[model samples]
Target: LRKSELKGLEIPGKLERLIATFFADDTTVYLSENDDFNDLQKILDDWCLASGAKFNIGKTEIIPIGSPEYRDLLRQTRFLNSVDGPKIPEHIRIAQEGDAIRSLGALIGNNICQVEPWTKVLERIDQSLDQWARSKPTMEGRRLIISMIVGGMTQYLTKVQGMPKEVEEKLTRRIKRFLWDEKTHVRINKETV
Candidate 1:
């Protein structure tokens, strides 16, 4: 793999030296060992000079990852606790436990937001079904609608990971309900529906 010029995050076993994703380098992520910010600051400063852009400190988030014990160790880092070290601006403080960080349109880290992706998919499906219910479309039309809309949802949402069994069942139930246009189960044959 090509080495990143903006090296920071350390990959175990020297696999890679940096972690980064770029859209013309507008946003970059660097991992500092513990809470050291001096290296990151210098890196950003260099990038700004080269690109003629300013780093936005206010929009920055410092999501702390690792076990609670690891976090405790991070808190005790000399740079983190130091009054003499280069100061981390107040708005760019490390995330507390239970805080969720949204990355690439997905909420991750601690808390209920971990389930946000599926919740949103479920909500969108319900809303769309409710609105489309008014049209009273033909069975073929409904089948087409589900294939076009709900089919994509199922494919995208379940692509990378297995969902909770209950959630999977609920999604199947919702689609089944929509297909039959029934509020309750009618005991119809599975293939017939």
Candidate 2:
């Protein structure tokens, strides 16, 4: 949608003046600054009809951001706190502040800076490492797996979010330990591997 038209719409807050990001078929409309859910839905419907592209309401979600006070305000004024909103389509979901929404293989939410999504990835890595340890792979095999599979899995996420230093350290420790057959408190000589 055009910024000029959205500005004219009767929506609360500064989002009306904000421009939407359009990439190919995906259009990201930021409604976090406004609490006008009904008006926004109407605009989306009208846009979909005019563009001849169906708006997949089922895939659409309202992800609220900001502090507790802002969240409360959004809940009270925008009807996003509750799961039920008569004005909102039945298929559209409302994601709470702390809820994680998977987008492009990364977890996104209001507090994505915390790297909560990495926890899931860490768990999966742990499981895989455990299985690999039981199989007793050779050092060369382990190195290949770590450099290829594990590294590949996290490459996009690291590039996107840059991951927190602590999370990267933890993953490094885990990988090193796994490489050493789960040996703890032992130094690994990099040149040997």
Candidate 3:
């Protein structure tokens, strides 16, 4: 759905502070520090009814992003109803501190700064590279794979999440070894003319 269809879904007074991103069929709404979840939910329910679109509560989540104390505060608060007076069903899940939520191919935790998600991405890349290495492609072919496949995988994540320098270095070393078929322990030397 489009943003125009979901207009007026933001909390009344906090409209200026809300941050919402719509990509394809996914819509992410970020409320301000002072916004109330109940109010936003009500608006969403109303929008769904008005637009004749079903609100899939099963796929929806309320993730608290902050310190432990702040998250605890969220945990204590109970969400009973939407602004329109409809009760929220008990089957809808609220994300806990250690819960891993996938959003747009990136893993998210309660704390926004956690790097565990990036580790998962790295592990996937390593597995893919290992599988490709089994084919015994030429060094030039390996370099092309590194540039196109590996590089493309991290390009978006690095720009969005800011990968650590050490991780980049380690991945680079692994790619180098894979390029040489992991036979020689010595490093590959390039002599300039």
| Worst 10-residue lDDT window, candidate 2 | 3-12
Which of the two, 2 or 3, has more TM-score? 3
What TM-score goes with each of the models? 0.75, 0.66, 0.70
Ten-residue region with minimum lDDT total, candidate 1: 75-84
Give the per-residue lDDT of model 2 (tens digit) for 1-193.
5633343224456544544656666666665343446766778788888988787777876666667776666556555434345444555676676777766555677754466768877888888878777888998989987887579768888876668888899888888887777776656576854
lDDT of 1 by residue, 1-193 (tens): 1243444567788876666666653465765544347666677788789989988877787665556765555545434433346556655656666776655544555443435467878888888887887899788988888887787776755654336677778788887888888757577787964
Question: What is the overall TM-score of model 2 with all chains considered together?
Answer: 0.66
Between 1 and 2, whose lDDT is larger?
2
Off by over 4 Å in 2: 7-18, 22-26, 32-39, 65-68, 79-94, 111-115, 184-193
Clashing pairs in 3: 42-83
In candidate 3 the C-alpha lDDT for residue 178 amounts to 79
The lDDT values for all models are 0.65, 0.68, 0.67
Question: Which candidate would rank higher by lDDT, 1 or 3?
Answer: 3
Q: For model 2, what is the error of residue 158's alpha carbon versus the real structure, in angstroms, after optimal superposition?
A: 2.2
Which 10-residue window of candidate 3 scores lowest in summed lDDT? 79-88
> Candidate 3 overall Cα lDDT vs. reference?
0.67
